[model samples]
Target: MNIAYLPIDERPCNTDYVRRIADSSAEVKLFLPPQEALGYKKLPADKEMIWKWITDVASEVEAIILSIDMLIYGGLLPSRIHYLRNTEATLWIERLRSLRKEHPGLLIYASNLIMRTPKYSSSDEEPDYYEEWGEHIFLRAYLQNKKQREHLKKDEELQLQNLIDTIPKKYIDDYEERRAFNSTINTSMLKLVKEGTLTFLAIPQDDSSEYGYTSIDQAKVMKGIEALRLHQHVQMYPGADEVGATLLARVYTQLKGKRPRIYPIWSSTLGPQLIPMYEDRPYQESLKAHIFAAGCQLAETATEADIILAYNTPGRVMQESWDQSDKDITYTSFRHLLTFVDQIKQFLNQGKQVIVADCAYANGGDKELITLLDEERLLDRLLSYKGWNTNCNSLGTTLCQGVLGLQGNKQKIIENIIYHIIDDYIYQAEVRMKMVEDFLPLHNLTYFNLKDKVALVNKERNKRVRDAYQLLIRHSFETITRLDVQTFAPWNRMFECGLILKCEQSEVSKKC
Candidate 1:
């Protein structure tokens, strides 16, 4: 299985993982187009140059993994050079269609642009239509239309909500519109797969950030993948550096028939507030208690935690107050975390598996955090800490890569990672029970079906679970193991003993 991977940019974790996986494969090549190079402030304006670069790379490989964002647009950075509509996916689709006509046996797996809320503001730094006259013109048109309405009041504020809502929500969510404007760029690649123009089509899971929204129902998109029968033997993971690594490793190993060395990098902060914005009263209260309990456990048994999830809370005054003249102590805490990164890198360099998930709660602080830690010579000690604003997406990617190296088959690897995830949940519950004794009964009494158990467990834990699970998952990736009695004995015995004792007391009271 000859493989070729084209990462969107250098900072992308997917490329890094793919590189590692390629090391274990017989024939795996990496092709990062010059226009899509990392840290390139702007892509080339010449459309022919871009097309030539993409075609040149695609021409060499039997299978290609292309980032739709990089291929159609330039990068996720909201800049004129990174614009997608102008560069266009239609050309790429045509090129791939031509390729399929030439070599129908070739495989192409491409990721679609799943809408995500854009964090970095291109308008803030660049003079664009949206900045110069787009908002103003829209506002003026809205006001003029309002004034012409005889029954309308003139006091209405010229707000974005009032103007943008004019465009119907259903229209925006329309499948045809999504495919045409965004999904088509990626789906067209898959069309090649369906028509036997390509062999395997892997569509990456896109987050809300791609659509310029805070959140999205990824399940809906996933349902579409299922409906199209694209889920069968298809390798799909959350598109992050680590996930790409894992998927590539699994695919490569399967093709090469050998185990590969796996290395994981973890970086993140934990001090961020539990509640960013309040939505539900009950949920907020529960979250606060859970965070406090988790914090107390972290501070007390920091060593027990595989990875520390830390972040600076928003509101500079509050952050300052939290620091409270303990700069040295705070610095020392971060240093200790960096020490773990260094150690993990050492293990990886020694040809052992290493996983790194750096948590950044308040966005855009990872660079400063990395700088501070590097001042202590910690960054040099690790293999990679390549991005800013680390999140769950990166963590999941790393786990996928690590698990992939350990497991040969893609679906089996996913199942194994999930199984370890279950064990991780039980471990955390045990920790929580130890920290807050009152919750022990609740934890023990909760009963979920197999499917519900997996879902519920996944929901409760954050990135830390990913870290710990990866450690154990590396051990069980290839083997089929049943849940031993030991996994449930502790909680089950506690519940059973409690129930029996209560029943005996009730009988004695009745006899008395």
Candidate 2:
């Protein structure tokens, strides 16, 4: 019941979100490293401090979930930019071996990221050279890898040649050298899993695509898994921030000796077959992988299920959340939002726990879906709900919460749902871009950097979030008599913000 967790980074998604999910369970007591030891954005954590924290807590905890990215490279972003050689990386691997040797009975679960190569040019989370050649570097690898899988068109081949000729050789060398090293470490991790040093391992691909460096790296890791016969022991899927929470769900479910059965109902029939943004496979494929990875199973029927996942997805074409206002024709013609809501109601009336995965659009929630759920007054009754970032991100987090909510504290569960509605819906879907465009320009600020105006930005963001929540959530759920919201711009960027929620319901006060 006592588990020590080291997150992928200090981001709220990695740190605060896991804590909130764990708090939902009455049986779980989770301990995390001090905030200062986790480090800031782009700056690596103090590995020695984190190692000391892990060693100090090892004796008291029955289980420990670690982010190898944090342990070996200090943090997630740091993993992408680190200059570590194999000798140094191997030293950290040995450290893990020593920990396993020290605690022979410890139930260890670990997660490592397959470094992502973003298609766009931005150094916000990458090296300085990425500011110029990020897109080119990504394309070069993508084309090169694609050529091996299948023949490229003449135009594509010409473009690849041009890219190779234009980009400076040194940048490609720097980028690939780090990738080769990270891939080597990934292989070493499999050896640990094979030797029984780790009870389970998750290698999540961050910002992946079908043909690229990530796919190439995934092939190598998969080969290792096959060679070591770790199919039951390891899971490699498309995810990043949500892996920590997924592992926690696995630990909780396994400890309780309960494998929760989930039945998924999609809004659009074609939704599951079609892939969502920033992922490499179909939504259903990733959903199945995530279900098993979280220590749960798929139910053939709703009656036999512990939780019902009402997955709201696009009809035919998937788009970003911000573009929903423009409206896609397929979304209306191919999908039935009204029918999806009705099914959710039927399940609830049947006395089944229902959770909503509002992944109709990427990067945020679907307004139409949330509106339907709200009109039916189903917001406060669901076990869990999420719609944010990539489809897998939302799916993985919602699934984990759904599993935990089976026996979790009711107040905590309700508070967590409201927290996501405020965050995933009100802020991400509605307020973030509006604030960035209308509010930030008045102060002469940029979306990527708030500079000295972080407080000013937070003040405006918190007010807007509260106002949106009042309109969208509080009006429908009267049990929420009062709600106070405070938000922080972690890394001083508008892309993602951390929120603190204090709720006073008719029954109890839940601070999330």
lDDT top scorer: 2
Q: Model 2, range 1-512, lDDT digits (tens) per residue? A: 99999999999999998999999998899999999999898899999999999999999998999999999999999999999987898798888999999999998999989999999999999989999999999999999999999989999999999999999999999999999999998999999998888899999999999999999999999999999899999999999999998999999888888999999999998998998888899989998999999999999998899999999989999988888888799999999999999999999988899988888998899988888888898877799998989888888899989988888898788888888888897888889989877999999999899999999999999889877776765335566666789999889999998998887777643322
After superposition, the stretches of candidate 2 with alpha carbons farther than 4 Å from their true spots are 508-512
106 Cα displacement, candidate 2 (Å): 0.6
Compose the digit string of candidate 1's lDDT tens values, residues 1-512. 55666564444234433554344333455555563343342333333555576567665766566555555555433222233452456676776678667655555555444433222222332324334343443343334444544324545553544655664444333322433455444445545655665555444433222121212324444555566676543333333223344334344444555433322222323333232211111212322222221111122332433333222232211121112223334434543545544555445455443333333321112323434443443332222222212233333443334433343333323332233233222232222233224433344433212222433333333233334334433322232332221122211222110000001112111211
Per-candidate alpha-carbon RMSD to the true structure? 21.3, 1.7
Error of model 2, residue 121, in angstroms: 0.6
Candidate 2: residue 274 lDDT (0-100): 91
Q: Please list the C-alpha lDDT of all candidates, in the order they appear.
A: 0.37, 0.91
Candidate 1 lDDT at 56 equals 71
**Most accurate candidate by TM-score:** 2
